[model samples]
Target: MIYADNAATTKISDKAFEKMLPFLQEQYGNASSQYSLGIKAKRAVEQARKQVAEAIGAQPAEITFTSGGSEANNWVLQGVTKLFKGEDIHIITSSIEHHSVLNVCRALETENIKVTYLQVNKNGLVLVDDVISAVKPNTKFVSIMLANNEIGTIQPIAEIGKYLHGKGILFHTDAVQAVGHIPVDINKLHVDFLSASAHKFNGAKGTGFLYKSASVDLPNLVFGGKQEHGYRAGTENVAGIVAAGYAIEENVKEMRKTAERLQAMVQTTVSEIRERIPDVWINGNAELRLPGTVNLGFNGVSGESLMNILDLKGVCVSTSSACNSGNDEPSHVLLALGVSEEQAKSAIRISYGKYNTIEEAEYVASAICDAYSKIKSAI
Candidate 1:
């Protein structure tokens, strides 16, 4: 398959898989047990934590393992919201955030916490000034994604985080789509918390982490025996965590070389699409987007129809977030960027990864143009 859905998830790397095998077989042990095997497991977990921390320029103690990005986001949103009871709490977040943040904000509303959904520009960016204007005396926290999943619009998270510092308020970023794909320095961003998923960067599924600063105290989302320094509790997935560390280390080390190739492919694809197809709109900030994510709106064609055709052609792409797949509704992110529902429904997202080749990109782009032509002709 000429897979172009890297934004949805990535396949595990050979190195990560090989490292995981030993943990799952002979090295398997309960991290909480008091034995040699358990001690080995505990050491693996700590090493993974350190690797993850180094990847993001954070302290190892700040990293807390979780199921994935979703849980980490929920933990921060719910845990922080619960901190202030019988008092006014306001959260400022972008309208184009991943469902992890949006859904949690919806639940926060029912708990008497006020949430302000900041609007994005046509390029799907939240302005720093808007964030400042949205903050009020009751505004207790701010949560926004480092980069959008579907459109790949990189947010001005560092600016927002820096501004919100020393105001007695907390800042968190859902960096699931941005972490390994680009350079992420938690200290530089000035964020109180950051969330990331392993699978997005070619690690095993069902594994991820959260970075919480020492100053930002939060209630535990999972209740059980002490693990993750009592911040998160459960039997740690030693194998998955070990694989994550290896994957992230590899991804970060080779990011620049990989990014250059992907960017070249993206340019070729976009130039081809525009030259061959008519009236197609490129979503998100062109210059500020992720390496190989292309969200294109074909005026006279349906995205779902194009996706089905692509799948039949052995090419994999997506309309939006995998979490919101099958919903059949226009993307909330596109709508936030002032795209009409009809236009939003006609957009497709194509994301590339390390495994994708220039030849695959050319073929995918050609196939899309062919599909669009057929769909437009019929319409």
Candidate 2:
């Protein structure tokens, strides 16, 4: 099968898998134990932490491992609410954030926390000016995603981060789709917290980390024995952590070449599909998005129908975020971009990965074009 939905999840890399084997078997020791085997596990976790920190230009002390991006995101958003118990708090976030961020903000609203859901332009970009305009005296924090999962639009986190930093308002970014696929520097983004996941970047699933700047302090979400610098509690997934470290390091080393190749494949796919279907148009910013992701609006065609057609042809694609796939509602991100529900229902995302070849790109494109034609003709 030609897999084109890397944005949802990526196949684990060989390097990461190889490094993780020993930890799952012979090196199976609780990182908290003081014995030699436990100490060895603990050291491996620390090494992984350092690797993750170095990749993102952060201090080792700032990284906190979690179950995945969702947990990391929840930790920061919910944890920050504790810092201002009695006082009124306001948060500013884009309307296009992952459900993890949006849902948490919604829950906080019940507790009288004010939230501003900033609107994105037609291209799925949150203007820095809009962020500034939305700020108020009670604005305690802001959470914006670095790259969108469905459309892959990279936000102006650095610009927004700079403004928030000057105002002393806490800033956090959900970088689950951006981290490993692109360059991320905490110091450069000026964000107090960042979230990432292993599965999105070719590591084992169920492992991820949150980057909290050492200058900032927040309460713990999980309570138990100390595991992550006493900030998070639980028995660490040593194998997954080890795999994530090696996966990210290896991806970074070959990032330049990988990006170039994926970009070329993206261009080829888009051009091929457009050649066959002239009315088809891209849904997000053509150039400012991630190298490997493109959300295409198929006009009158139903995205779910097209997706199923492609799947039957041995090609995989997605109509929206994997988390929201089964829901009958149209995409919230596309709706935020001013797209009508009809248009939003016709959009499908094609995301590439390093392992995909030029041949696979062409095949996927052909499959999409063929699927689109068949679906359109039936109507």
TM-score of each: 0.98, 0.99
Top candidate (lDDT): 2
TM-score: model 1 vs. ground truth: 0.98
Query: Global lDDT for candidate 2?
Result: 0.94
Error of 1 at 242 (Å): 0.6
- Residue-by-residue lDDT tens digits, candidate 2, 76-123: 999999998899899999999999999999999999999999999999
lDDT of 2 at 24: 95
Q: Model 1: which ten-residue window has the lowest total lDDT?
A: 214-223
Q: Report the poorest 10 consecutive residues by lDDT, candidate 2.
A: 220-229
For each candidate, how many residue pairs have backbone atoms clashing (under 3 Å)? 0, 0
Give every collision pair in model 2. none
